[model samples]
Target chain A: MGGDFPRGKSAIAGLATFGVGEAPGFSSMELTARAALLAVEDAGLRIDAIDALFICQPDDFFAGLSFAEYLGLSPRFTDNNRTGGSAFMSHIITAVMMLEAGYIDTALIAYGSNQRTNGGKLATSIKPNSWDAPYRPLFPLSSYALAAARHMHEYGTTREQLAEVAVAARQWANTNPEAFAKGPLSIEECLASRIISSPISVRDCCLVTDGAAAIVLTRTDRARDLPRPVVPVLGAAAATWWNSIAQASDVTTTAAAESGPRAYHAAGIGPADVQTVQLYDAFTINTVLFLEDLGFCPKGEGGRFVSGGTIAPGGTLPVNTNGGGMSYCHPGMYGLFAIVEAARQIRGEAANQLGKIDVALAHGNGGTLSSQATVILGSADTL
Target chain B: MDGMTGGPEAQWRAALADGRFLLQRAISSGTVFFPPRVMEPGTGETDLEWVEATGLGHIYSLTWVSQKPPVPPYNVAIVRLDEGAQLMSRIEGANPETLRIGQRVRAKIGTQDDGAPILLFEPTGH
Candidate 1:
């Protein structure tokens, strides 16, 4: 992988999210169209100006074509690349490549899901693995529980540490009005919650909600003409080692170990330079594993690193400022929200906005800790 | 032999029916993998051979499924076979609450509700 691939080549000019918690009487496509139109409007561009479309819906086949048709778009370039939750981050990489190559002028990445109102079963198009199907491990929760169990056994990570993640997320959520879970959360409550899977209480899991998010990407020069600050794509990279948890060589680690460094190298920045981070917190263990894999802390020290309000408000590191999927909203795929929140922080427009965020990191995880994608975005000064 | 049929999975099922557990080993790289694949992962070696597993390994990770009444809870575990391959199976003949990671276990072929042979595990040396 070239270190300079698509570095600072493109910027996100506009982003919008619709149906964050619940949007009754709205189909996934309708939600996507709503967000897409809002994003184009935010960029001060007409919907007809979107020359490229990137989308992935769990229920739709050839989602890009369906979304393009739904929005009355005949984009010259379209991508329906599906890596589960991390697909949106990967879309950013592809959009940057197309923009830098002059294949397309403006690109839109969109996603939507109605998993909550339509019942909380994962609306994934993927069939169960023949080997794993027989065991009936609860889809993704059990896979994450297995990793949590292994992490505890190997590193002696206490349950208190896991509870802290949910607590911190809820604390952040209390500040965001759009957060689905906006109540005071304590570590004791998280530890006492009903166990959905061993070591993973109901509190540790992300919300099941209806939502759609879209972001528009264009060349940095064109983005400069837009009203919003140029949140340049400083770096982007993705990696996938295994699709199943049983196949992972080490359950305690994720592919973020591979994607994180590559993205950082592309951006010419390290973890130290990041002012805030938005991690795909589908499960509390995800934050622990990703923090270690992304070089925020040493391996096996993630449990300790996140404890003691380290990632909470008024903490050393501000994480998931939009309340994360664990509390804010998780509509099947949560990666796009991470990017959306990162852009908000970079543009100084976040609801729980931090001060002077020059650089921010957004990490996305897909499948059962399978695919990992890292996107490092920065203000124009960083370029 | 129960008339071994279909692909690698079918062969694996036949072996389990005969009260034997088997895993695949790549002939070229000597890497072992589970769930019976046509080609070796990572190495893409098609020339693979089946070997009888030791049926002895430790629990790499374990989780107990808490079910409502009328359906009893069970344990789902990833066992690291001594052969270096890992597979998801349930631990039987032991209290579900007592199971923990890193505990040594032995495999046993148990019949499921459908009368199909399935792989199971029980704590060893107890």
Candidate 2:
């Protein structure tokens, strides 16, 4: 089981976010810079301490080098990897590798988007005008909905089961202060929401938010010396089987099927060791799919597993403690937030804190469930 | 509009314009691919033939689009073609909500906003 596994001695030292929603006229670049500076401050480190930088090219707007120049910081290692929303988690894995290999000491990963303020609906034509354009899929939502419909067809998954996800996310959001949604939601109300696409209601989709998040990662020795609590990396992995949803072998499953087990195996822990989960819930269907694929439940059983509030506040498993994308801020990609929330949970700092979290798993889903990345974090005691 | 003008994309488009659905079949592996590729993904073989698809398949998956359709609600679907390739298209002239997975469908040629020939599917029984 030990073939080129990372030692996972790197830890998240600092985390920060800004411009949660509707940031007036703030550009993505500006919001990103603000968050980067805040992250450095949270780590109690000077701007010069960062030697590596990783940033996402959200919606083809910015690159790592351009952002590095804009931020007026020169770095030795840089990556502008855009694997959809999951890019941040992938960056964390990269940073850990670099840290282990003596390539860099401190790595800062950041993401920012103005999806709401720019009036850019993700449903707009985002793909190249191929032969498939005539089909009018409306991008990701329809792509995801198509998969959801198939899930129903194959497993008899009901629409109410999907609504239960929205309800649970809102229930969690009620306790989070920085979250965009902080109200009560009912299963019946969720079902009554307008259908964006069949089998997917308006409530099923993530919030279109204008926000940014940043985190600082360093060697465990350095992280421990920093002012903030340390959330040590346990294991990380990523995989992608297809880019286009149509080409996926099984629409009901995702790359998480590969990434999840690999990360857990690398961490030397099973699903039973995970105390909390920060799964990317861009859609309710996503949570259901991950719950099954990530080994929380049997395949085709996610519909029943999520029903009856199994993942809600009082449930045995507390997922998406920060409300998740269904109610929390989605911006464009919810990947970074998953890691940020995971770190918060590992440090016992989450607003809606779950009791005695020792090990936390953050699963990031990108594209139409095309790409996936998983990162497991543990507290100092567990490490 | 003949075959020699463009690459795989154009070849498929030209074939579709001629009322034929085209897919790439690797000569060595017998692997068929949709959205027409120049090379086989598995063997990376350039020795591929533009085989005609029967335009017959069942719905592998489908979604009902309730927003911003040129018309009203429409179905965007992935049809697992009889040739063992899958393509993204829509069911033509059928109620999207009524469409079911595994429903048999046949390919139909359609024009895009730019007047490019594209492929769509409709229930075979309809």
lDDT of 1 by residue, A1-383 (tens): 35567788799999999999988788888898899989989998999999999998988978999988888889999999878899999999999999999999999999998888877767776754877777889988999999999999999897899988999998898999888888888899888999877888898999999999999999999999998788999999999998889878799989999999999999999999989999999999999999899999999999999999999998999999889999999999999999999999999989899988989999999989999999999999998
DockQ for candidate 2: 0.79
- lDDT against the true structure, each candidate: 0.90, 0.85
Stretches of candidate 1 off by over 4 Å are A1-4, A125-127, B1-6
How much DockQ does model 1 earn?
A: 0.78
Q: Locate the minimum summed-lDDT window of 10 residues in model 1 chain A.
A: A119-128
Model 2, B1-126: lDDT tens digits are: 243577888777677788888788998888888767768986679988877788899999988878565768878888999889887888887886467888999988887788877787889884
**How many residue pairs collide in each prediction?**
0, 0
Question: What is the docking quality class of candidate 2?
Answer: medium
